[model samples]
Target: MKSPEHPSAGRADVRIVAASPDAARQVADALRRRFAATEQRSYPVDDSGGTRLHLTVDTTHRPEPAQPWLVSSRSSGDARTQTDEI
Candidate 1:
């Protein structure tokens, strides 16, 4: 598939899936330090029972990787929407 024009394009490709805020922060921090990235962002999910985080890097010298994370394009049971049976 063609790469996204933006990271959160089709669907947010969450790199860090943490159970708690602290855990998410640690993961984000680790990624930032390791990659020397500028920033990391996190989004909470109400229906998915977890939190998601992403780390982005901008570089013209090196081409970005294709789909670094395998995030689903479909919402499915994600917090954006849920089943009617609930």
Candidate 2:
């Protein structure tokens, strides 16, 4: 696996459209360590739609692989994870 860089360097790209608090926090912690940056923000329940987090992080400095963190096809967007685990 590759090492994470600081957000200031823009090394990764991550987004969480809807995830449970526990999952989100776990992912967030992993992300913080992986990307070496604090979270962007926490959403309020009203805006979150539920007890899920809707967060986005931009780390575009890293090299692009065969697949990326997100994929878009005109009317929709999807995520196809490249790693076996976060």
Top candidate when judged by TM-score against the true structure:
1
lDDT tens readout by residue for model 2, 1-86:
98865444544455554445566677776665434443555554555554444344555432233344455334344566658857
lDDT of each: 0.60, 0.51
Q: Give the TM-score of candidate 1.
A: 0.44
Residue 63 lDDT, candidate 2, scale 0-100: 25
Clashing pairs in 2: 12-59
Q: Residue 72's C-alpha lDDT in candidate 1? A: 38
TM-score of 2: 0.35
Q: What global local distance difference test value does model 2 have? A: 0.51
- Residue range with the least summed lDDT across 10 consecutive positions in model 1: 57-66
How much is 65 displaced in model 1, in angstroms?
25
